[model samples]
Target: MNTRPLLEVEDLRVSFPGTTGEVEAVRGIGFSLGREKLGLVGESGSGKTMTGRAILGLVPPPGRVTARRLAFEGRDILGLDAAGLRRLRGARIAMVLQDPKYALNPVMTVGRQIAEAHRAHGRASGREAERKALELLSAVRLRDPERVARAYPHQLSGGMGQRVMIAMMLAPEPALLIADEPTSALDVTVRTQVLAILDELVTARGMGLLFISHDLNLVASFCDRVMVMYAGRILETCRADALSQAQHPYTRGLLASLPRLDRPAETLPVLARDPRWLDDARADA
Candidate 1:
């Protein structure tokens, strides 16, 4: 197995030009990813999704993304042109978004959409793409692949739609997958199923996975390592099994806030905000 990281980021900063001044959404943060599951946990507006988007050059116009170093497979992402990034996006890296309702094409059949992804990279002929689409649908554990393939996005349930989205992303056979709250919209049972599929696929393919979500318990339980983010900064990075032993106050607060069945609390404590934490240069890894 290759010991080198699949992606490396250093001092990554993303900002938007605003009327008041430049608003920094993602403050300077650094991390590296190998062919393993790495979870990013934070509340909304903490810049979890933006970090993932910035990695793929999807920060949109007017939002400036800069980094002291940002590289994927030893290639500088900051230097990749439109054409180069296009080839790299879905082929070498892919992202699964929060909701399939918004991610999937409502009018296109599931199979055609998956086939389109496969063909977009010129990876296969039309027939081959179609075959791969069905294979991927099955790979995601969707029963009756033929029927699901013929169905439209709206015709499928939230779980099924998400499954189709995953199948489509898998069509490109990406080496890295950035899943931004992929299971947040699904029910508990379905969420478990979708994650199981993701776990199996990533492990079997030896792909690197960046799992982004706000669920602290979920990240601790599901990911190999967890990065706790607050105010666009990573306060701590620790092994999943050791999340309870996290030294950062923010991480401890998050863990304490989780509702537990075994030990119930009358009320969850409000997370105290500290401006100094934002300026903390130290990362407890």
Candidate 2:
């Protein structure tokens, strides 16, 4: 078995210039990833999304990103030039954003977009790209992929659009995928199906997945490992199966707030916060 990590981040931090001073969006968080599904769970503004963006060097301008060591396959990603980072983005590491309606092109056909993605990576010719696109559409379990490919993005349902996003991201067969809430917009029933498709593809390809979401219940069940974030830092890291036994007060508070179907509570508890969780960054659980 290959023991080396696919990606390793050490002391990663992102901050933006504010009126008062620098606002730390991601505060010195670090982790390593192999070919496994890892979930980052936290409430909004907890810096989960910013952490994902930083990996791909997608942190917007005016915001600065710094790390002690941001290496992918043992090479320093932080040192890569624009050209090198561009090559790595879709070809080696891809991101599937929350909504396809915003991510996909408004003018391009879904087939053209997929083909373009493949061609951008120098993976195939126009003809072969289109063929591959059709194949991927089917792989995502889209019905009548030929017809769907010819259609525009607006024509597809929310679920179908997300599948299209997945198909596009998978076109390059990247080593790692950063999915930032790819299913939040879909319906409850469709959410399961989309997750099933994503899970199946990621497992078959042996790709590392960094799934970022706010739903603790979904992350507990869907991911192999889970990291609980609060105020720009990971407070706990534990096996998804063992989330119920997580020792951190923040993790426990999150679990307690969830509505249990097995034993329904009269009222869901509100999360009580502590100031020390932000000040002290424990190494790990």
Candidate 3:
């Protein structure tokens, strides 16, 4: 039984060079993920997705991802070349984007797209890949697996499309899964179902899960641990159960802003803006 973490990121910084100057999207974020599901919760520009993309080496040109230490399953990923990163992307680590519409190809059948992902990671052949794809769809609790496979992205509803994306991501059986707002586009009922599927898969496979979202209540309930970020810096890291009792000002502010079910107010609390929240010097040290 290896006790080491599956992924460890330390002092990660992602910056983009612009005409005006440089924009630092991620500023020295650090965390370790093991078999448990971890949530990164923040606002839209909080750099949660950027951190996930940096791990996959998906940062586009003009943006540089630098880290003192970035390891996946005990291997240094920061130094991996394009080929190495590609090999690692779907094989050892996989990502489920926020929207399946953009992630999936319009021209390709859902089954073929999943099969291509499997083949890219050296998984199986044509027949075997189709079988595996159906199995994956079934795992995600999708009905009519064969029919769904033959359908295109446009043919499926938002929830179904997301399930298809999940199936494709899980086909490779990666050790780590990064789901960026995986259920954001779905309705409440479908979102619950999709999250349940993800929860079961992670627990059954003992895989590390990086679940990123802006919904604090969802993250608090779903993830084992939670990392609250603001302006690319981690404000607090605590157990999910302790989220309501968070001590950081930013964390408290976020909680205050969330709509309460039992205690309804005429208006939701306004989020206060503080310059110190974005100060990396104070956040890091």
Greater lDDT among 2 and 3 belongs to 2
Candidate 2 per-residue lDDT over residues 143-175, each given as its tens digit: 899998999999999999999999999999898
* Candidate 3: clashing pairs of residues: none
lDDT of each: 0.90, 0.91, 0.90
Per-residue alpha-carbon lDDT of candidate 1 for residues 10-112, written as tens digits (9 for 90 to 100): 9999999999999998999999998889999999999999999999999998999999999998889999899999999999999999999988988899999
Expressed as tens digits, the lDDT of each residue in 189-239 for candidate 3 is 999999998898788879889999999999999999999988989988889
The whole-model C-alpha lDDT of candidate 2 against the native structure comes to 0.91
TM-score of each: 0.97, 0.97, 0.96
In order of TM-score, best first, we have: 2, 1, 3
Off by over 4 Å in 1: none
Task: After superposing candidate 2 on the true structure, give the runs of residues whose Cα lies further than 4 Å from its correct spot.
Answer: none
Rank by lDDT, descending?
Answer: 2, 1, 3
Which is the better candidate, 2 or 3, if ranked by TM-score?
2
Model 2, residue 36: C-alpha shift (Å): 0.2
